[model samples]
Target: MPIQQKDPSRASTYSWPGVLAIALGALSLVVTEFLPVGLLPGICRDLGVAEGTAGLAVTATAILGFIAAPVTAIAIGRADRKRVLLGLTALLIISSVLSWKAESFATLLIARVILGIGVGGFWAISITAAAKLVPPEKVHAASSIVFAGISIGSVIAVPAGSYIGAHADWRDGFMGASVLAVVCFALQLVFLPSLKMKHGVNVRDFFGLLKDPKVRAIFLTVIFIVAGQYAGYTFVTPYLEQITHLSTAIVSVLLFAYGVATVVGNFVGGAFAGRNLHNTVVATVWIFVLSLASIAAFATSPMFAGLSLLVWAVSWGMAPVGTQLWLYNATLHAPEAAQAMNTSVFQLSIGLGSLAGGIAVNHAGLHSSMWLGALILALAVMMVYIVGRMNRQPAVAA
Candidate 1:
């Protein structure tokens, strides 16, 4: 069944406060999701686990998030969205506290699983709701703000956690996340509107998206680009140390620069994608592929490596919004379902990319991961072209 069309005159007015709160919530959720990435070594030592085992703290959230997203979307059908978002934020707070108090790896993994539920659900709603929180003209800006939270999370939160955990204790990172979550939760409770469901997604709507070849193509583009990006990026620091001989401080500065570029890329992406999603994705993927290839082929010098990393960050950072908009436009009726599936695939791609990178690092060498990433991303570019050709049918609203 198609979604009913809305009268253009009844469009929402911009609500900066509501949108800002959602962006903050998005930032907090991403920070909580990846908080352990920066503290893996510390977690291993404190919990008496191997580094590989401690890595599960990050994996647990992603795997469960992949499962939780679609389920939460379907289960919470027709429920008040504001209440659901608030409940998810509360879950984040509890998960953070539990992470702080966890004594064993099992305990910590349990907390991450809980956090995954919130992360998945929060993402599922936040992106789809952005259009609702503002006038149609400002939807792109609102969506960009929400995704900027992701870039900022990648840029600041993880590094801050590492610094805090090193200065104090690993648990301190969790404590900080808990405090931030509390603040975000309170703000949402006070300011977020009562966003009741206009239409509920059913099992059919969820499955219906896969029936579209274009949607499948979009998902494939996401998987290949994201997985390839992470495959190389997971071991980037090691590559910098081994290949470029960069010191820890230089590496930190380079990473910080990369983060900043990503934020810039987010806004640029919004503009580009808003004007032309196909061209934005096509251009971004090539930039991503070329950057990785540059690092693989010519990163013998620190300057070259740093420059490649910066370009990669900007291209990849611009990706989420462009990709989200592509999927939303591609499946107008099933936007939530599209977003949910995209979220799940995004999480899965991270895990896949990391796993692939780990294997490459073990068998080939650290530098080899860059080559692997480039190869997969080239395939992604091809996928994008193929999808473009197949999208001759006009997009239909659900």
Candidate 2:
């Protein structure tokens, strides 16, 4: 069944504080999700694991997140969304503390598994929740605000984790993430309103969405794009260190620069997607192909490499919003179910991408993963174009 549309008049009042709390939740989850990327070396050293093995820290979260997204969506039917979000936020705090105290790789992976559930459930509901916080006209803007949290968290996680690992310890980074989650929980507890579901989602609604070709295309594109992005990105630090021969400080700075570009790209993509999602997605995919290829082609040149990273970051920032907008537009009737599938596919792709990249890194080399990513992203471009041709609907205005 389609979700009952809320009265437009009632949705006119924007709940900025509640939206910010959701964004904060996004930030906290993202930081925990990607912290292992930056601290892989330290984790490897401490846990007596190889670089490829340590990357499983990310994979663990992605895999669990993949499972959790749809499960949470269906299970939480008609429950208070505010309470669900708060409970998820609390999970973040628990996971972070567990990560901070982890004595072995198994313990850390267990903590990441917990974090994955929070990440998946939070993402599945966040965009829909944000939509309810504003007038229908401003839903795109509200969704962008939530994505901005993702970009901002990326900005903080990698560089800050690197800095902390260099000066203090990698474990401290998890502790910091725990503190951030605590803050997000408090904010949400205060500001977020009771959001009762008008219609409960079910398993059939999830599978029902797959019948739409446009929806399938969007999920396929997400799989390709996200998988490709993570494949190359998961090992970026090692690439910078070994291939570029950069010090920890310079790598941290470069990662910070990449994060900033993502933030700028988020809003830019959101703006363009609102007008023309097809073009925005196509352009972003092209950038992904070029940037990942460039990163590989110019690995020896720090200047070229950094420039490519910035460009790639912008495309990365643009990607989620554009694809997400496309998905929402395609499945307006079953938005929650569609978003759950989106979150699931997105996280599944991350897991597969990182896992593929790990296999490539272990066998072939670092540069191979970049080339592989570029190739997969090239495929994404074609998929997006095909989807555009299949669905010639008018663009939905923000």
Candidate 3:
């Protein structure tokens, strides 16, 4: 199906074909990035390792994603964006093929590191490239449409992998991701319109964006929220089985609820942030704290606990988009820098949170970890709000 463009500026110059092609391009890259998460259970069963160890496969991606993303963003900043995107899509396809053939956990982990490189590089270009494809007024809308690919791919890839793991081979799941990348690559070559980019990008120019207090604040806020949220989430399924007394099926249902709520919260957070970035961040962070506390307090109550999950689910949704918007607004003219910084911050948060969550799990108990997460989110709210007030933006990163 062809995408329909409404604006007059969106003629053949940067038609709907170019725009939607770019969006699907983002979707496929993100699926490749996150495929390991969906593949975890199967990998663990096959490798005869614990689920946490399988999660290391996922962590490996982030560990590499943070390091690879910024460097690639700078190296490719001056290149033709479409060509960079096309190259990354090709790399993603190779990752899928390699993942399908891995004989051991180390091989799989190495494959994931490669995928991480492609994932980070793909994101570093996609949005900034898409923004250039259209008129200035349509940049935000275009960027959102591109981001929607990530959300949609996230929602799809896990279930798709889970189903393949149940019925077919785990290898098939990876191969399928590769197939998707091929289709996206074809679409990009066919429909992506050429456009001008801001040139003369140097390492020093990239570093300059980091010095801004607002940019640093937003980056720290993302690191805080993501690290805090995932610390609890990484250990959640085990907690549910041990502490919440839910069966596997019921746990699936709870996870389903959380996933659905997160998708909902993502769009809702974007809407709120568009109007008042500060208020939205403040409101969502507090809601996040309150919800985590509620879930921890009522861990045993299914009905109440379920309600708490929904609230927490909403928080998960708000956190990503809110943070991204904060960074974009912070960088102003240099949106690519914002994107690169957010990617790094997000990965760092995951690495730290997972490490911290493990320590908390070993020392305190699953339930106590949730408390730590809430405290961290509370701190993030404080950091962003205080920064916002100081900058006189009032809500630039709230």
Candidate 4:
């Protein structure tokens, strides 16, 4: 069934107001989701836990997202997405407040877990709902636009919060996120056009995705791309400082530069993804591999490594999202499930990448880690090719 979209803003040339609203929702999710990563040192000092223990603040949310998103997608079909988004945003408010007051690592972890449920539920349901906010022809654009928010929010918000924590306090990050979540919630309540799914959620719908070849390929691709970049990205500091022998200040500047490059990639990837999602994903994955390999091979070249990191971050930004739109295209019937599943897969990849990076960094030199990443990205690219083959339909050519 095709979607019905009301003409709204210029951004919604193909979408409705709900797509923009969902992007707002995505902004909140990305901030809350990556907040701990930025504030880990502060959280550790405040809670009197080791940084590793404080890191669980992020782990808890990610684990919860993995556990909760799929089921939420199945259970919450065809409901009022505006209500759903508002409810999740309210949960984000509550969770952020809980995180603000948490005194112990365990308490923070509990709060983070609650935060994860809100994020997981929102990601799973919101993108599919955004798709509904646009006409069928414009579904790709709407979905890509919402996903671009995550990339923008992650690269921009996490760093800003980290800067705040460095200057003021870690709790300030949570406080700011709470205020933003409230604003997002209120905006959704006001400006978001109401929408309903084309059909109700069925138990059978979940099982049906299991039989699809495209789902398997997409799942693999997500795990691959995410795990690869995360492996290097999680340990970019060591790569810059130890491998490249750059000073901390210079490394930070380069990292900030890399982030800026990534934001550029997000917009470029979004535009291309709206056209041909599969080809865009494949191209991004390969570029991702080449970028990682270049850094690993030329670690002593700081200028070259910095340039490679820029490309790497940009391409890394592209894959998680570009593939998401690809998954949306593949699982047209269960768009919610596809979106939610991609979140779960990508979240799981974060955990996996971090763990793998830690292990590889400990056992071998940091230089070897990019190879490990490149290996995974290669697999992800392969999955893209295979899935494209699997999902290939007879194209209507001019």
The top-ranked prediction according to lDDT is 2
Better of 2 and 3 by TM-score: 2
Give the Cα lDDT of each candidate: 0.79, 0.88, 0.73, 0.74
TM-score pick, better of 3 and 4: 3
TM-score of 3: 0.85
| Reference-based TM-score of each model | 0.85, 0.91, 0.85, 0.80
lDDT preference between candidates 2 and 3, better one = 2
Across 25-58, the per-residue lDDT of candidate 2 in tens digits comes to: 9988998899888898789788898777788899
RMSD of each: 4.6, 4.1, 5.1, 5.0
Residue 361, candidate 1: alpha-carbon lDDT: 67
Q: Which should have the higher lDDT, number 1 or number 2?
A: 2
Give stretches of model 2 more than 4 Å off: 1-15, 133-141, 271-276, 393-398
Off by over 4 Å in 3: 1-12, 159-169, 194-200, 235-249, 274-276, 358-372, 393-398
Q: lDDT by residue for model 4 over 186-284, one digit each (tens)?
A: 878877766555565566766787688767777887888887876666556546666899865576567667767888887788888889887887899
Kindly list the per-residue Cα lDDT of model 1 for residues 1-398, writing each as its tens digit. Answer: 99978633222444678788888998998888877766655686799975445556666777777887888888998787778889999999999999999999999999998998888888877876666777778877988788777667878765665555556798999998999999998888877776666776678987899998788888999999988987786666557756888765576567668778888888888898878878888899999999999989887887788888889988988777677777877888777788888888888787677667767766787778899999989999999888776664455431
In model 3, where is the ten-residue run with the lowest total lDDT? 6-15
Worst 10 residues of 4 by lDDT: 6-15
- Local error of candidate 2 at 348, Å? 0.8
User: Alpha-carbon error at 5 in model 3, in Å?
Assistant: 24
Candidate 2: lDDT of 288?
Answer: 83
